[model samples]
Target: MIKAIGGYFGLEMSRAESLRYPDAQYFQSARACFYALLIQGKPSKVWLPYYNCDAMLGPLQRMGIDYGFYAIDEDFTISRALRLAPTEWLVYVNYFGLCDRQQAEVLRRFNPAQVVLDHAQAYYSPPVDCLATLYSPRKFFGVPDGGILVSNVRVGSTAADEEASHQRMSHLLKRFATSAEAGYADFQAAEKSLEAFDVSEMSQLSRNLLACADTPTVIEQRNHNFLTLHARLAEHNALAFDPSTLNGPLCYPFLNERNDAVRPDLLGESVYVARYWAECQGRCSPASWEYKLSRLLLPLPCDHRYTDADVQRVITLIEKGLKGD
Candidate 1:
């Protein structure tokens, strides 16, 4: 049976000459990537950061893998002083993609083979010699439902590509065509749809879109936008890091005493900023450093989508919001 030659056309997409991690395994979601690793290693216990989103606990709970919470210091370092058993792993997040130094310290202190580097926010940060490194590319790019896992652990290949990628595209397309306000409903729907926690291969649609990305340009733009924000607000920001170590950070995390008040003010002015993790408040005590970080850290937009002028506008609005103007 021969197929018709060029009968109809489909979506046209460009193929990139190279990808950041060409040999990395692709999964439907970051949690699925972690699940793949957990299933392979069968770790006896795992430790997660208390200052993280509850979504991360999904794979572990589903697999019946025992897990405990660990505390993060004001500087995002692991505060726990416990040694891991032979079959236990510790998950450390590259918080706001601004903790390379802390990540290096963790690698130095802990056994590299028992560490899980959650680079969900640190897409541009390369993987170190660890048990596994997981990345949720959707956080940084326009693609829908794709995750990258780099590790020595062989979670053999799969052909069962996720089928819901097209359905989840509504929000990305809507937001691109119109404004964020217009697409808010669809965005919420898209997010809710991914709660199923399906562990499958990355969908072909998402993989193609990711391959089409101009990664070099995006990285350059994101770094520039981040520095643009940091240059003006470094003195006021409580979270300190060397600007030289930054590599396409997720956002410029600005911590201030007035963050709780200014967040709503910025929203009122149509400048939406995201809180790191509101769920941490329910888990960690109010006086804990992690809880304080959850309450005051404003992850201001510094991705590749905006220009320097746009960032300056956000800075001006932040200043006004702080002043309660």
Candidate 2:
């Protein structure tokens, strides 16, 4: 599974991790706060990455918030956009678990009051000091609906309602029965009725999973799986690491000059690989488009669910595929 899926992926444990409950469902609230802040005193402009989720842009659009796009260099850092304009609000992403402390420092120099750290990808080693930090638990852990937003700023109090709670519990029960697809369907159904302003319930199952998560073990497995993939794929002269000063890589991104030709061959072997971000939806830019097209990011499963053998199988398949044997 590690070989197939890739990245520090894992099945969340049942008991033993910390539980944040109402506070855990912070992403929505943070969005709400941003909206409220804009209404009270709309900033001149906000900045975000061209490569990002459409869901994030929804709130900004609804709030009538104006925004701009920044460029990600070959190193995946925002070095050039710092001097673009006097940014009022900046959304900083910890892309693929690579720490962006230096990027954050640059943003801080411009306007510390307007920076929002989107740690949705770097949940494992999230930053502590930031004006605000938002995370989606579902991406990293097995959760139905929960996100954590931590900040010193005060926002309105609108707790998760009963319907959302029931729906979340239903999803949990369905997931526990090993029907993940069914659970996901149910979640989608619930999302349809959710109001833009309403707060959704945090999944207890997700909280429990986080509390029971083995941090040290997960980290070790992730690093091991990543290193294995790197060692095996590095010999291919055509494949090279996305040059970035990443302390920890959540996914092993490789630049394949012949991706259009080689991708199908790899997939034919039942090695499911992703061509992540084939299309940039939100705020598309020339630099982002160029950066995205030249790369294929592979996630190595380093989560507790994967073992050493899983990593080996993935590498073996890659080696065979590369040889066309």
Candidate 3:
């Protein structure tokens, strides 16, 4: 039989919690938020980082907005800085919640109104003073479907399909009932549904679910989990990031040239890690650091649900992997 460990970490609320107010406006997905903002801003074009998912291209292409790409250093730092004209916007990702507010303050070099910050990985990081800040709660929580957009620009309001969350919840349910492996099909189905995207408000189901969230627990537990895992991996880890930079992290990103071996080693120990992106495999050369890093960088599990034993188990597995056990 398949096994399971953690449950949903989204907002960390229990079943007994009452559904109250959902404090912010939400959308169908981060991509939908991008579409809505594009409609309102009508920018001459957008400047997106070369290190990005092609999903953003969907909305920009649909809107017929002129766009171009820029590059980032291995440290994920902006390789080249540009001050776009008033009619254009620059999109920046806070990466793994490691880019703190002070780091994001660099955008002030451009007009705040021209920046679009993607907090898809930085859910708890507050919105910087930018034209728009897009969030993917599913990236940080157990929610079946939802994305939040905080923007200075105006977009048309649209009521979202309430049933969408139900269609996507099978995997989440199966994970709770049995093991995450049992929910693989539903998870794949949920992922496939994103391409049929639209601009809609967050569903009441999601809003009610979000209302039950315990904000403080979500922040504290995740921060603690990240640090605990980092402490074990820091001396040998490839990320040049400072541990103090973590706020509410998505995962413990571990860099290993042998990620191919590392992944199966952990999986054999019932600890499954994730590959951040598959889109980069063909676009960049295999010999390049970006390509190899993209291919081998393993995002380790350190979400809130894991225990001290769980963390120790991961450390043990990694050590075993390093030793080629």
Candidate 4:
């Protein structure tokens, strides 16, 4: 395939070593990775959480695999008693990366071979000994789409490589050039484009962009920002846990009634707080913990993009908003 030595240059990206999970399988999306695993393993039935987005059930529904919903306690622990047959599996989401200890505890009760670890929110949390552990790198990085699967299941067939991610780069470029609000519509559209994805290998563009990430700095910044938020807002936060325990959390999930009340106002101040799952109401009862979390929980930004001062700004705005100012 080597023909010309040099002619015109393309988009230049860092060749620096990026975060690498050497022992995992890569796919186009977390759903694609899950689909690949299911296509090969062919589990007859699976159990999922009611708190989850409908996207998680795509693979199972596509294959006509039967599944049941389970409930979780306030602490994110499975609340129901479960018994599984030989051909069944359970999928547990590492909610907001704060439930590592709980995840480890849950894995003990089930056969390690029948449990699937959904680390979509827990990217920094390493994969443990399990049947199949799935990670959505796009959730944590700037890459368009990528999924990592660390599993005991053997690969039966290889999916074709994904098409270039240039089309998906519109929102990213738009946001980078201007403001998040300016590109909000493009971002939503880009996300919707992946809704009907099939199993495929990770795109080369995404892989290269992933290689440019500053892993150590990103982890440190996330931890620092999260702790900063927890320090100021822990009293208002309803969810009780040691804030310093998590490695690199997705965000500082400040589960306070005040936080939820001020969420809409914060966006007016250029602080966009995301709801945990807006669509969970259809699948979850109003009295359920998940439904309450959906409405009450505020996932404040504590990622690597902001500084300590930026965090302080958010804290002050939240405090002001809570006072009805």
Candidate 5:
């Protein structure tokens, strides 16, 4: 499974057992964190990466927030920007589980209190302190709904009892009936309606699934599988993996010289590789598009659901696909 999904050095839970509410769930969804930040901070100007999910821009625009795009290096790290504006808010993404410690430090140096770390991808490895840290739980676990907005800034009172109950019920219903097709449909409907969907509504069943998350074991296995696949595929000159400082990785993203040509073969191997942020609104600047188009990112299943044998099978399929056999 790890080989199939390709998240060799990705995020995992810190604990196996679950909690009652916020404690149990780390981050909810990238979209949720995006919304929450807009609601809570209400900053005038924000800075984000050009190579991020397009879904994020909608909320920012809806909130009438102006944003600037920063340039990312070949390694997908944001090392340069046009200029440091009076940007009251700055959003930093922990891209693909690769934490850019230098960028974080730079942001702090400029304006310590203005940075918001979107740990949606690099939740497992976080800085000791920051103004705010956001997470998307579904990215790591089997939960249907949940997100955390950790901040030094406090908000007003909690949701009313009836409102909370109604939201919870709606979440449960959505969870019970959700399928890939249904989810796609829902997204289409939302796109038509111009209404943003909140991802914090997990069903009881989904919550139960969260209880089974085992962080340490998952991390160990994922790293092992990642190393194995990396070593095995290293001989293939046509395929190259992203070299990053990953304590844990969320996907094994690689650059393929023949990605457009070999895509069909990869799919036939049952390798459900993704273009990741291709459809993300205007987030894909020219540089972002060049990198994404030139690369094939594979998210290996690091969860407890997959075994070493599954990893080997995935690696074999990838090797065969690369060989054009």
Candidate 6:
């Protein structure tokens, strides 16, 4: 019954913290923006996180940009002291919307030209003033496909033709009447479709959905749900980040060793937790923290559309996993 009624919705409730981007270009994916920026900058060397997706690195690799990796500390800050030359570029992920104001501000200390803030996990976190910020709207909402990039560098191009997004929305659609599990292939295919796509403007359908979103309500709800879940699970959770730190967190990113046992229970309850990135497996060694984090982290949904009761349900389910039941 749980999977029948509740599983019809997204793995997480799709909500936009806001639709207000004053001057921005919408693309099919964040990678499209990265491609445009790399093309325009023509940087010789690129810096990125060791724990990252191949789609992100694909652009740099294709351009033959001399690339280097940066490491993240336990809390996912820039643990490694890394630097770039005057004409090089750097890209960083603000994991789980937990990057502090100071950490974000430090990027601005560099030439704004060299900094690309990947807010794929953060929607409500304010864009570090005058820095290039990349947002994946699909990650935050029920939209089929779209990415927004706000930057000083402009690539001379308009929205290119795009594959119809309706095909990509099957999971979101099927979940309403069936199980989210049934539509998994549709979701995976939708994501794979974005990789081959180059620079393009946001689709009309995506733009319209974004325009109609109640973003403020979504942000407020996300904050409340995250804090509530954090307060309950913080003692057992191994991550060092604070719950008060989230603006509009993508999810309650609780990292723990027990995730392998807990996930199936949550699935049985129709409570789906996202594996932040499976690509971490193929990219890093088995002993690497990034790889372990990929396998163990539970990105539990604490977005809008869930109430306190729902929060408690998820907590109860998680506790069951901790006990190895």
Per-residue accuracy of model 3 over 107-157 as CA lDDT, tens digit each: 756787888888888887887667888888778666777888887576875
Which wins on TM-score, candidate 3 or candidate 6?
3
lDDT of 1 at 120: 96
What number of backbone clashes does candidate 5 have, counting pairs of residues 3 or more apart or in separate chains? 17
- Which candidate achieves the best lDDT against the true structure? 1
TM-score of candidate 5 to 2 decimals? 0.73
Better of 5 and 6 by TM-score: 6
lDDT against the true structure, each candidate:
0.86, 0.57, 0.77, 0.84, 0.57, 0.78
| Candidate 5 C-alpha lDDT tens digits along 229-289 | 6777666534344545545566655556645655676567655566666654344545454
What would the TM-score be for candidate 1 when compared with the true structure?
Answer: 0.94
Q: Give the root-mean-square deviation of each candidate in angstroms.
A: 2.0, 8.0, 6.3, 1.8, 8.8, 6.8
Clashing pairs in 1: none
Provide the TM-score for each candidate, comma-separated.
Answer: 0.94, 0.74, 0.88, 0.94, 0.73, 0.87
The digit string of per-residue lDDT tens for model 6 on 1-325 reads 4546643553343435345686787887788877877778788888788787777888888788888887776767665477779878778888877785645555655676687888888876767654478888787877777878888767744664545676677777876678778878888887887788677777866776777678668889999998888888998888866656767888888887888989989888889787767886776778888888888989889988789999999999998899897
| Candidate 2 clash pair list | 6-299, 6-300, 6-301, 7-299, 7-300, 7-301, 16-211, 17-211, 17-212, 18-211
Task: List runs of model 3 lying over 4 Å from the truth.
Answer: 1-24, 81-83, 101-105, 285-289
Model 3 earns a TM-score of: 0.88
Stretches of candidate 1 off by over 4 Å are 1-13, 156-162
- Least accurate stretch of 10 residues (summed lDDT) in model 4? 155-164
Candidate 3 lDDT trough over 10 residues, lowest sum: 15-24
How well is each residue in 1-325 modelled by candidate 1, as lDDT tens digits? 7976886897677786456788799988887898888888889999999999988888899889999988888788888676788889999999988898999999998999999999999998999999989999889988778889999988955664446788788878878888889878887887887777655878888888887878788888888998988888888888887888878899988999988888887888788887779898998999998898889999999998898889999999888877778
lDDT of 2 by residue, 38-74 (tens): 4544667778776665556666787677877776655
